[model samples]
Target: MALDRFALPARLRQSRHASLLLFAATLVLLLVAAAWFTSARSDLAEAYSHVGSRQQALTAANQRQQEAKLRVQLADSARSLVERASAGGFAENEWGERLINISQTPLARDEVNHLLAGMTRDHARIFGADVFELSVTRADEGLFDTPGSKGPPLMLNLRGTLLFRTAQSGSGVAAPVAALAAAPAIAPEAP
Candidate 1:
């Protein structure tokens, strides 16, 4: 009995050892599977975050591209407006005649001064023409001292190259032709 208690049967001992080994192996495998699942979940979260950031960057880039395109269109429209204004020959001639008439009118000294200032500022807006080197002076001599007249008769002296649009060239593009406008020293007689 003492020997039996001290030593188990070989088969039973072996079976107990095997069962212990199997339980240890199963615990280790469960731990490994848990670790792998945690790592996979972490990797998946990082990938989702990276995708979100990339999507935001792409949206911002698209917005910037749209803004750049709008700016280009605005610049093209402004250039077209200027080109059209320069192309109209009759409009320029008519604007010149109107300026001549305004200058020939006898107005008060202050009024003439205001008109000259307004002409410089409003020429581009009203006539759609740019006038460089504009000079306004009294046309009639000793007219400032003349009685019953509001002020001296004025003359408009326009000097500088005018931007004229030439006919379509060989490239099918209308080129700007600069022509010097002759400035008359004396004012033309009123019709």
Candidate 2:
């Protein structure tokens, strides 16, 4: 069975311009589709980049919020500790002595010495305390020594330096510090 090659039209057989026109149209369509695809890909990439940056910014903000919260908590805890220390240090009826509230009163020499001795004895971490020097300047001519004084004694200035040593926690342990230092380092175990 032989197929007839001249079955269509005389115009198609005479020239190849129609076939060239068809090819050109197809090429143009392909180029247009390629350009559209490239533009769409670039837009998609830009959108993804924007979304990534937004996510990073959100993560950083959350971390900063957490840090701020932790700082506030720490400050509150420190304030509470200071309040407790102040209250326990100078209680109203401390040392079984019933006296007036002297938190704001200027302390006498004897009273200051008593307080220092009490602190040295009561502190858990302090091993020893020594007052190297105590200097006081009296503003009035005859304040405490005089029998008739209207107001309390006026002190111009008072200065003192306290030298204290902190007690080590594991000083009584069996292993000496020198021996521990001389010992070889142990390798960590594998997981």
Candidate 3:
């Protein structure tokens, strides 16, 4: 009977050792599974974060495109408005007739005299005393000799200067002298 009891105790200890080993193995597997699950979750979160950032970038680009289109439309509308105002308000009616008359009309001697009279009349400080000599020469012959010349020979050169009243003091008190002195010097034209 004693021998049987000792054998029974030995068997119980062997079973306990086996159960402990199985429990340890199961714990190790659970730890590995938990670590793998955590890693997978982290990877999924990173992918979702990347997708969200890309979406934000795409939205920004779309907004920029919309803004650019709006600016272009606004500029076009403003330009059209300016064109309409200039065409309809100020230069619409007489502009064409004025241009045609300027191109077609040839200046006459009476017109030149009237123009000069008007100029002297406008400035009250100057009076024409006498026109010393008057000469008129046609300049159209030389002008038309060139190739590609348009229009008829209509140019005339008038050489004459009207004597105007001036201060006898001959000092710089004369208005004509002041005007000539204040006038800007003509720059030589480019070749």
User: Residues 90-145, candidate 3, lDDT per residue (tens digit)?
Assistant: 22221111000112224444454453443252222233322222233344443324
The all-Cα superposition gives candidate 1 an RMSD in Å to the true structure of: 10.9
Error at 43, model 1, angstroms: 1.0
Per-residue accuracy of model 1 over 1-191 as CA lDDT, tens digit each: 87876566776788899999999999999999999999999999999999999999999999999999999999999888867855653233333233332223344455545544443432222322333333235444443454345544444333322223343322444443222122222333332
Give the distance in Å from residue 71's predicted Cα in candidate 2 to where it truly belongs: 1.2
Each model's TM-score?
A: 0.45, 0.38, 0.35
Residue 90, model 2: Cα distance from true site in angstroms: 6.5
Model 2 is weakest, by summed lDDT over 10 consecutive residues, at 92-101
Report the error of model 3 at residue 1, Å.
4.6
Residues 1-191, candidate 2: write the lDDT tens digits. Answer: 12345544555654567788888999999999999999999999999999999999999999999999999999999888867854654321221211112222354545554544533433331223221223334455453464334334333222222222222233432222332233233221221
Ranking by lDDT: 1, 3, 2
The global C-alpha lDDT for each of the candidates, from Candidate 1 onward, is 0.52, 0.48, 0.49
Two-way lDDT contest, 2 vs 3, winner: 3
Off by over 4 Å in 2: 1-22, 89-191
Clashing pairs in model 2, backbone N/Cα/C closer than 3 A? none
Identify the candidate with maximal lDDT. Answer: 1
Tell me the lDDT of candidate 3.
0.49
Tell me, by TM-score, which candidate is best: 1
What is the Cα-based lDDT of residue 85 in candidate 1?
Answer: 59
